[model samples]
Target: MGVFSTTSRYSLAFLVMMNLCLKAMASESDIDFSFKNFGKVEPHLALYGDAEVNNHSSSIQISGSTNFSAGRLIFRKPINLVGANPRTMVSFSTYFAFSISGENGDGLAFVVLPVEFPLNIFDGGSMGLLRDRKIKFLAVELDTYMDKTYNDVNNNHVGLDIETPVSVKVGNLSSVNLVLNNGEKLQCWIDYEASGKRIEVRVSKFGETKPVDPLLFYYPLDLSQMWGDEKNGVFVGFVSSNGNSSQKISIHSWSFKSRMPPPRWMHSEPLDPDNVVEIKGEEGIRSIPKRSDCTSRVVLALVFGAGCGVIVAFFIVFVWIVVGSKRPVAPEELAGKGNEFEYKKFGEERAIKDGDGNGEK
Candidate 1:
């Protein structure tokens, strides 16, 4: 049939060039912004020191009372945290909406460092991080100062800073009556679950709802040892300080998201190896297909090549209907007629006359 319509038009132009090369390798350098109302800021955000932007209430103040103030706001790109496989790790979530008033003396974090770090190394109780020590971070703070030198679990807590500043899990905002420095507007959340290397934290009091537990939990955090793999990338914002008291710190609304870890055939449940916490040279936390794409392996290879071309066209129409039913021919072999041949009528007479002469024309 015109060579199967020229082999189905070269297999649909090779599946549209393999679906544009799997959408450019499952392209995803994800990071989403929301800022419901930071009015104008956003020049891809990367404010440093005393961060600003408060067009009459479209908040963002991040550290003001001054006494040795410091601030940051980050997000000038570096995202990717992990996905083109490199020992898989990539999952995130964030939300913000802060507020803290004066006299709290230090606190406010949520970092993830290493994107050439040094936005000017910080000081004063580590909220603005990097009091150097071979810098490496991954914070969450929100402290409010009680610093007995990093052992603070009092001035309204919620910690989890991993490359030091001491808190290896703290959370205790007066057990939930919530009071960070009392200026009101709270709300925080943080998630990260590259298949249960887990991490979760939550808080409330802004518009409420979104607190089904998790007031801090950290476990096996193998964020690929914090940016030393998957081709390095990491830099997600917010930091603050006001150490010797004079604290302000505002920051109204914010958002963040990241993903990549779903393809275990789209998992339908089975990740409870006792709530997975296997870390120690990590590996095997299964789930790989968030991005770095193959468009679901090219849509399952075009549905397995159209179901194997409809099972090879139904096995070539079942061998052409069993060779066209043995090509027809048996009505008693077309009514048996051939054997009556010797009907030499006109020849009979000539033969009789010429028989004796042994020849006849």
Candidate 2:
């Protein structure tokens, strides 16, 4: 009974250790998600203002026919900045296909804001990004109508704005003869290199690669400073608006990729697994380091110990079964069996001697 109790305890411990190992392994793996087609509204995206998923056209319509309508679509998860320093920037790349129709007044923009749920700014010429001037954000605006009040270059142009309506850098979309409100699909690529502190923006007709010379190239665009969050993370999304004239802005497809650094709590040595892992928006598989956290190391030790314990328990049970099967018989039964064996041996010897005597005679 005591042996059985010990074995049972070891078995229970082994199961518990294995469970912990599995949980730790699951936690160490990074999360990667993608949505090829927005047949329905994605759970990871939050639609505020006038944004709605249009299944009929397989797109996200930001604004419809209503005047003074403003829309914002935000990614629910906040992207982690690379490091603690103000200059540490996170690298990102995104490709999107969009179209705008009707009387395009205010236009649309791709925004990176510090707050997950940001307040709606002014409508019309502000393009839904005019606030109390305290909001820290950046944007790439595709202006389809000229706003003289905002110092817009022309009706067709792309501008990079830093926390205000007036852009620090502007590029004429007419240089490539690209039309925004013509109901034609347009493709745009935005790439940010944190190491070089460079941003490249490309726009072209649908189904075409980025031009050799990007439409807009800016340097020293540090996103970490623009984010200005306690954790230094930022929310990315799109915003659009319509003034007195109404328009329809739709996003047919979008893909976002970024590299997320390790969390703050995991900054200690030995147990700290502070490795950069890239999260591809379309691809699923990526390699993760072995010692990503203290939990992983603990789980690994537990798994090894449990495996040894299981082997020892199995050996002990095998020895016990063998010893139990070879138990000695009763003494009286042994003596009786020995006597019958001696009597048979003597009779065989006597018969052999008689045969030898006969042969001699």
Best by TM-score: 2
In order, what lDDT does every prediction score?
A: 0.77, 0.75
Residue ranges of candidate 1 with Cα displaced over 4 Å = 1-9, 12-14, 17-29, 32-42, 46-49, 52-65, 68-108, 111-193, 197-217, 220-236, 245-257, 265-361
Which tens-of-lDDT digit does each residue in 76-174 have in candidate 2?
887765544555556678778899885766788998878644445443436766555567778999888898977998988898988888888898999
Residue-wise lDDT of candidate 1 within 1-361, one digit each (tens)?
Answer: 5445555565677679879886666557456677777877888787878888888989888777467788899878788878777777777899998988847767788888887778855655467766756768788988888889878879899898888888889989898888888788998989987766788999899997999998898777888876746365878888988777787888888889887766554444324444434344466455434433446558876887898899789657755554555554656864644443344655687778788677543
As a TM-score, model 1 comes out at: 0.31
Q: Which segments of candidate 2 are over 4 A away from where they belong?
A: 1-34, 84-87, 116-125, 260-361
What lDDT does model 1 reach?
0.77
Indicate the residue-level lDDT of 75 in model 1.
Answer: 79
Clashes per candidate, residues 3 or more apart or on different chains: 2, 0
Query: Residue 51, candidate 1: how far off, in angstroms?
Result: 2.0
